[model samples]
Target: MEPCERARLHAYFSKIASQFAPAEPAASFLVTHLLAERPAFVRAVAAMSRLRAVLPKPKSVNAAAQREVEQAIPCDTLSRELFTDPDTALNYLESRAPGESIVLLDVGGYFTPTISELHSRFSGQILGVIEDTENGHRRYADVDKLPCPVVSVARSPLKDPEDFLVGQSVVFSTEAVMRDRGDILHGRPALVIGFGKLGSSIARLLHAKGVQVTVYDIDPVRRTQALSQGFVVARDREATLAGAGLVLCATGSLSLRGEDFPHLRNGAYVATVTSSEDELELDGLPDVYTRTAASEHVTRYQTTGHYFYLANGGNAVNFLHGASVGPFIFLVQAEILAAIRMLTRAGLAPGMHEVSANDRAAIAATWLSYFNR
Candidate 1:
């Protein structure tokens, strides 16, 4: 975006910043994010309470953004290290957080595993956690016990922005792939795994682009929903993989595995819309198919007469191939701010929860007032 446009967006955020203050002051907060490049966003969240440390994604960090964060909060408060690994992130948190009066502001559920450790070590004083991804929310479901409240926007009605952006990313990536290999999407069959918000959006996007789409979801309700939406629903994985020209996994679970590779058709392109490397099972790719045809973002594997393509090397293909979510991202940031505010409320029950409908609607209405007007 142009500098003038960036400044205008930041000004809008600043106008709405006061609407999201925490009810009770937090001792500290640990934020795990890839969008720390947005100085205005970082400063807005830091203004909510005392920011203990930031666990920024290595891919998202820039010298200017880091400087912005340091200038907003004390330099000593921000950690220079990126939180990529679970163990390292846990260790860093354990050392810095005093345990009591701390909240986790997370995007990928990187802190899910450490929640138990933090609760045990800190005597259950961890305030709460705010998560923004479906993959991260899944981790919360697996846990039988949670010492503090956890709110997720991934499963909430407020995820309209993310849903819209998911479609946008797919369109951009599909166009790029087609440009590289003409008419790849023309009259081609594409398989989409998972029928949740992101998956459903992707299926529609591809269908609108004239690619035949078949959606697969483990949930009977989701499968029914996909079918009702006028999209073909796949009954089995092997069958779907056999006929698909493009296979995209948006399922939060590890949908693609090592054994599933053999099911893929020759000249097929497989990519992940879901978060993390495990979603696409990148470890399963054999070394023989090591030809890098389209930079590190796209991997090519050929065996005998068959060729297969992997987008973003099993990472979230959208981020690798398309631009950021733009203004829609601020909606999520606002949701995170609201979640933090909710955490300060008295008697919030422990366990996974959605950011209340009231909070979501308020943010949406506020956003529309600024841009929709």
Candidate 2:
């Protein structure tokens, strides 16, 4: 939100707006983390079409600030709480503009089911969707048939840099939260439960901090990649969890459940790096365990002789401290804008598609030129 950052973002978005024709009029729905930079991205999307409703992810931090920003834009900020339930979201969307053409811009496919339901009622009225996260992409991937064109920037090469920075932010925020409780990560045992882009980055960064990082991934290929990177790969997940002083779950799925809680080392700190609560089954905490608040961002769950800490109530710890990824995030945001532009064109096929390589290259070139200058 600095003056320089604002000016740079304005210039970048202006450049993108010039590259594509104005979007055909359609109501827009956006689901995203309400971070500081979100207002700029929202503004960029608003420029392309009519923004109907903005749904902030419940797990994302800084809702108050982002809500204030949304006041200036001509859109309704939907209830973050109600947005989670697909049926409720569908009802809200239906009530907003009945029988009108609508487009979706989502972060984690929170509206996947809502869109599916909408398609059943008003098929072609739903123009298309632009999804921005791998987590969201997987949600759409699970569907047997999509009702409209869905463009994903999740796995695009343009997102590579943003993924790297996300990992860095996770660690940075984790350290800050740990420090609040008079703890440090150096020379401690750590277990990272996923070896995907975010997991691998977290593992490497933790290892660089002198933490003995052990990695585990359900995928053999990812495990091999972790091993090749010179970090210990966990073959026995329970054993690794029992030994680590720190545990970070990077998998977007349910990486940890109630049954897995007892395996954690006593007094060990656990955290997640994904926006969804699905990453950890916190509600599944067994009757034996007693829960207590250790601090604003840390929770203590103890059972008899065993206990472990949960950071940020099992949500992404990075968001507890605002989840800043610096200016590099603009690359991915620009790609999302480009994806929205793609959705505006006629005759696009249904189902998920990668952000076009030409669009990716153009965005990357613009990013390089802006930063280099």
Total clashes in model 1, counting residue pairs 3 or more apart in sequence or in different chains: 0
Residue-level lDDT tens digits of model 2 in 103-190: 7888876667666667666523777888888878888888778878898988988778888888998999888889999999986699
* lDDT values, one for every candidate: 0.71, 0.81
- Estimated TM-score for each candidate: 0.87, 0.93
Segments of candidate 2 deviating more than 4 angstroms: 74-87
lDDT of 2 at 283: 74
* Residue pairs in candidate 2 whose N, alpha carbon or C atoms collide under 3 angstroms: none
The candidate scoring highest on lDDT is 2
